[model samples]
Target chain A: MKMTHKRRDMLVGLSFIAIWIVGFAALTLYPLIKTFIFSFQDVDITVEGIVTTNIKFENYRALFKFDLNFMDLIRMFVEEIFIYVPIIIVFAMMIAVILNQKIRFKGVFRSIFFLPVIIVSGPVVAELFSQGATTLPLIEQYGILDIVTNTFPESISEPLEKMFSEIIFILWMSGVQILIFLAGLQKIDSSIYEAAAIDGASPWEMFWKITLPSLGNLISINILYSVVTLSSFATNDVLRKIRIDMFSPDEGYGYASAEAVIYLIVILLILGLFGVIYLILRKRSVRMS
Target chain B: MITTWHKIKHKLIGRTITEGILYKVFIYLLLTSIGYIFLFPLLFMLSNSLKDIDDLLSPMVIWIPSKIYLTNFQLAFQTLDYFRTFFVGLSVTLLPAVLQTFIASLIGYGFAKFKFPFKNVLLGLVLLTYIIPPQITMISKYVLFTDLGLTNSAWSIIIPASFGQGLNSALFIFIFYQFFRMLPKTLDDAARIDGANRYYIFFKIAIPLSVPAYVTSLLFAFVWYFNETYIAAIFLGGQVPTLQLNLVSFAQSYTALAAANQHFFSINEGVKNASTILAILPMLIMYFVLQKSFVEGIDKTGFAGGE
Candidate 1:
């Protein structure tokens, strides 16, 4: 009876997950394997079906050697992640902290901040940017872009200018991050802060000691979320290029597949790098406290 | 006088528990300014969309339009074929979202409740799927869909979703996983002891208890699907016209319409902005109506801490 009951549990659990297992195998794993294979071959759809010719590393070679803008786009993607992720995480944290306070009309503030997540699609964002709605009029009127360009080297200044121009868009992307942080903030027991206050610890001290430490995991989560959203956003130049190249007769499926594979690898490496850096910092902070 | 000044300052900047009047003022000011940055784009969109050509061109006419101009909206509505595309968009987004949310809940429940072989590894793979951009598998999926005669149809989008491979399906599943995990195992145990089967317990107990999770997941999945232009454009670009896909081709369509009607008015920023607004208007309305669930759902789901 015990053995049959245990067997029943296993069967029931597997049955529940049956759809997902099929989806994983058919949609995700199969396509992933096909893409990997297609990356190595010259693939064409000739109505008879997909025809493949083994091209060795030619697609990858062409990407690195002949594709001038691909490398640049990849660099810009990494740079944007570095610059934008921190800004987003910090801005979100600040807002979450503010919203968690005993303030008036918290709902209204949250609604406004989170509106972007609802309406923000690639086309909508592109339209907004094209119409110059993304940047503040003050930015241009004050010649902040000119000042930044003159102040820093071109490599550093270019991203800074891009950042300043799309500052609001960056803030808009933080809607989900803010919610994540706010949730984390709400979970922190008020009693801890009250106890610290009784011990004569200042708000500033409490923020660093209690608040920041408590939110460390959430910060990493936000980092991951920010990087993924920014990279995969419909308006992202790299993704746009990948989509366009898929149909280009010269590049076709193989080259596009190679590019897609490289992009996946780059994103994974970025996440792994962030994970390591976070682990190291967390360890040091733990030791110090 | 010095004592009085100190007392005033102390009152304005209280220590510890009570935030002083000065601090309260500072907090409000900070919040309002940050809130303005968030609203700036929408405000810009609203203001610009309502402007006539003269208002758009005038340097002085920044925020206020000279008058409420309806021409841009008229042209935009005609170009978008607003109602037809909206329903099409809704069908694709709404159906997929409902299916994805339901399937995600089932998968999430399975992960949360029963001990299965390689469950931990499978869960990790689900997270891995979220990280892998859709671009990687998109081409092959497109080919597969094309082969199955699913391209240029709602099924192209709906089929993947029904199978739990929809837009950000993994995230929805994770949310469900977190929510279901938070439910006490004792509930399931008691149900079983009362001769309730596993399926019965899931439907009767687990599903009923996870309303907040279901709401949060469904709302987000719907929004994400609605705004998903990348896959939608690739899959349903031919026959199925979503509002977003319409907006993507707005300029070209406007040009075509203008040439056909011989209406010599060139497409202006106002027309473009108006169309963009139309594309996002449904989502904006939905957000406003369900503002409470949209905001507080995150808190109730215990989304951040369940790891």
Candidate 2:
């Protein structure tokens, strides 16, 4: 009877995962492989079906050499991720700490920060960016942009100006990360802080020793989430360029697939770097404790 | 000496006899600036939407309009086909989100509770789905759907989700797995000892205990589906217009209609802004009404990933 019960448990578990496995295989894995195959072949749609001709590395070669702006866009994508991810993570951590503080109308503050997540997909955000609404009339009136630009070298100033202009956009994207951090903050036991306070630890020491170490997992999660969201965001020129290239009548299916494969590799490499950092932090924290 | 200065500083700005007043002031300062930053877009949109062509053209009339103009709201409503498209949006969003949440929970429960063959491999694949961008697979999926004659049909979006493969369904699965794993195994053991069947235990015990997870997964899944533009545009085409798509195309459509009517009542930025505002009104109302669950749901949804 026990043997049969064990067998039945296995059966139930297998049945539960079966649907996901099937769907994953059919919808995700199969499509991914098909895209990979099409990356090497010239594909044409006819009345009956798709026709394919093997084109070897022509698509990849064209991707690097023929596409004039592709390399520049790739560099911009990498640079933006490096700059934006840290700003977002730090900004989010600060906001989360503020929101998590004992204060009046905490819900109102949270709602304000989170509102962008809901309405950002609407035309208002895109319109605001395009029309210079995000530049703030006061800043522009004060010639802050001009002053800041003159402070830096021209090459550095251009990206700085762009970043300054999109300050609101950056804040808006930090909503999810802030919420994640706030949740992480809530999970830390208050008793630990109480004990530390009794031992005469200052707030600064408490933050580094207890708070930051406890939040390592959440930090990594936020890092991964922010990285993915920033890369695939509607405004990410890399994604837009990829989509345009995909349907571009000049490059067609094969070339776009190769570009996509390259995009995927870049994303993976970034994530891998974060993963390594997370591992190192975990080991160091364990040692320190 | 620094410790003496620190004591003085603490007396002045840190803590007082009032207790937490300093903290309150700091929090309020932070909140106000960030709050203003977040609210600026909506405020800008409202200001723009209410301005007439004359006010819009005048650079001095940036914030306040000389006179309020309300016709843009009416024009946007009519052009957007608000009632029809609203229902279409609701059905497409709710159906998949609801189905996907339940399916994801079941998969997550399985992964959390029982050991099976290739379980690690299966879990790895689930994570792969999370990290992999949807854009990479979009083209082949589109082609497949087109061949299957599912293009321009809501079924194209709905069917895959029913099997737990919707937009970021992997994340939902992961969330549920974390929630379920946190549950003590003693509950399962207790149920088994009581002669409760596996299905009975899951239906009775696991489902009831996972209310927060259900709420989080369903709410996020709904929002993602509602705001999805790329896949919706590709799949639904011109047959069904989602709120996001309609907001985007409102300008072009308005211009086309105006041209047909000999350019009577020329379209302006106000109309476009008005349409964008009106398009988000339903979501705004829904969010405000259910703001507590929405906020708490996000808190309950994600688990820290070290384990």
Q: In candidate 1, what are the lDDT values of residues A122-222, reduced to their tens digit?
A: 99999888877888888999999999999999999999999998998999999999999999998899999989988989988999999999999889878
Query: What lDDT tens digits, residue by residue, belong to model 1 across residues B133-169?
Result: 8878998888888889999899988888988888888
Clashing pairs in 2: none
Stretch of 10 with least lDDT, candidate 1 chain A: A128-137
lDDT string, candidate 2, A25-115, tens digits: 8889888998898889887766778888999988888878878688778877887777778889999998887777676788888888988
After superposing candidate 1 on the true structure, give the runs of residues whose Cα lies further than 4 Å from its correct spot: B16-18, B262-264
Residue A110 in candidate 1, Cα distance off native in Å: 1.3
Instruction: Assign candidate 1 its CAPRI class.
Output: medium
State which docking tier applies to candidate 2.
medium
Q: What is the lDDT of residue B241 in candidate 1?
A: 85
Highest TM-score, which number?
Answer: 1
